[model samples]
Target: MTISAELLPQHVAIIMDGNNRFAKKKHLQKGDGHREGKNVLDPIVEHCRKVGVKALTVYAFSSENWNRPQYEVDLLMKLLEETINEQIPRMIKFQIGLRFIGDRSRLTPELQQLMLQAEQRTATFTEMTLTIAVSYGGMWDIAQTAKTIAQLVKEQKIDVDQVDVDLFAQHVSLGDLPPVDLLIRTGGDYRLSNFLLWQSAYAELYFTETLWPEFTTEELDHAFGVFLGRERRFGKTSEQVQQEKIEN
Candidate 1:
């Protein structure tokens, strides 16, 4: 499917799912599925950059994911560390800016340092931004932002009356980037799963049964094709939107 250039999403966020299921289906260890899922991300990211996506945010690990078996969690952390270390060169080569969102305090110092180093190394890249959400949750993001705002208010940095939706949003994760234009969740999930509550307020959502390990560029194009067919009216009626477009 050829997605129209004009209808391409500026920012796309994905909730990658079903790695374990894919592993079980293949009669392989769960870790193998995660490894495969990790491998698939590079091509998808490259495709997004090639197709002019400005930013791509992926839900890597959620705050709730910590409750999983210790072995699995440890393997995931190890994979993340190794992937970050390995992807830096590719990110530089592709001129992609690497950024991480989520609470960093929970990460080991080594992993945190590696993440920071990766961000610093690719800080000058301008072609596209790849944000990995590890230990992240939509509610946690909101609460953290609110806490920051509360601190500022206590410090007399801002007045209580000054708080508004826009003002409050500025403190949330990815506050500097464009709002999520499309949110894709793989593995047949229909719910947001506390992925990006504040950022996806009006995002066009696409859910697919394809597992993360098998989600390909072609599937991505299909999602974009669907996105192009939808009419984004925001709060306006279709007639009003069409008339405004004509007036413009």
Candidate 2:
């Protein structure tokens, strides 16, 4: 329930993978795997909030996911909509803000409406924030930020030379939140898969063989343990980091 402040990750990101594989491995119906994965998030969210993480971001859908089989895509969309509907009250119950960061144009109008309303309903919760990346990709998020910066340049709001990391960062999705301190990928993947590329520039990465549906609070704890056991030096040498820690 409680963790050391120095070891706690203010922001955590999860690449929830292996739903279809879980289905095949379990001999379940075609879409049941996704449904099972969907059910796994609530407790994780609660646990994150309980452990003092300010923000939790999950990869729900990606821009590239549109290429999946139409039926599978449809199932994902339905599940997303259901997730929004189901999470709004839970968000309020836990005093957590719910947010969605991604391209909304590709979503159904009805689903978009639901997402907007859910965001509105939970906008005031300040204890923690849950961000679902739907139709989201790191490349897309950065491109959108670039486009906004270019538009501002065109409007002469600021000089083009003024565009820097800080300026560009402010325009990126979830820029107001803490940078990702821990990124967890389930299902044995060792790659980022284009999720939160910029936000997780210095995050501690945790990979696990457990499928998403099987990922639990215990797994999260293990990831935190791994994070604490390692050292994040940023660009500093080990000696410098250790000296700084001693000074603090």
Candidate 3:
């Protein structure tokens, strides 16, 4: 199907799930599913860029994921480091900025340093930004932002009354990027699962039964189509929205 560039999402976020399930279903060795899922992202990233998506943020590891078995957690962390190292060159080639949002204090010193280096190296790229959220959670993101805002207020850098949505927004992750326009989950889950709470406030949601390892660009296209067909009134009435569209 042909997609109209006019209505394409400015930013897209993905909740990649079902790697372990896919592994079990395929009878693959313990951690192969995660590896399979990891490979699926490259094409999707390229597809998003080709379709004019300005940014893509993916849920790589969540704060709660630390509760998983130690071996699995270790494997995931190793994969994340590998992913960053592998993506740096591609990011430069594609002119995409690479970023990370998470509690870095929990990560090893080497990984933290590598993440910072990657962010700084690709800081100026304009083609698109690819954000990987490792050791991240929506509540953690909001709580940290609130803490920062409170500190500023205490320091007299910001007035107590100056705290508002706009002021609070700049302190959150992805604050400088366009708000997430579409959020997709590929594990048949219907919940946000503690990811990108503040940034995806009004994003169109797409859920699919296909596991992360099996999700495809064609599926991504279908999600965009659904987003295009929806009426995102943002609290405006249907009549008012239609009238505004006609005037535009």
- Residues 58-134 of candidate 3: C-alpha lDDT, one tens digit per residue: 99999999999999999999999999999999999999999999999999999999999999999999999999999
Q: After superposing candidate 3 on the true structure, give the runs of residues whose Cα lies further than 4 Å from its correct spot.
A: none
- All candidates' lDDT scores? 0.93, 0.94, 0.95
Better of 2 and 3 by lDDT: 3
Of the candidates numbered 1 and 2, which has the greater TM-score value? 2
For model 1 the local lDDT of residue 201 reads: 98
Better of 1 and 3 by TM-score: 3
TM-score of each: 0.97, 0.98, 0.98
The superposed Cα distance between candidate 1 and the true structure at residue 106, in angstroms, equals 1.2
The per-candidate count of clashes, in order, stands at 0, 0, 0
TM-score of 3: 0.98
Q: Residue 72's C-alpha lDDT in candidate 1? A: 93
- Residue lDDT tens for model 1, 141-214: 99999999999999999999999999987989999898999999999979999999999999999999999999
**Top-lDDT candidate index:** 3
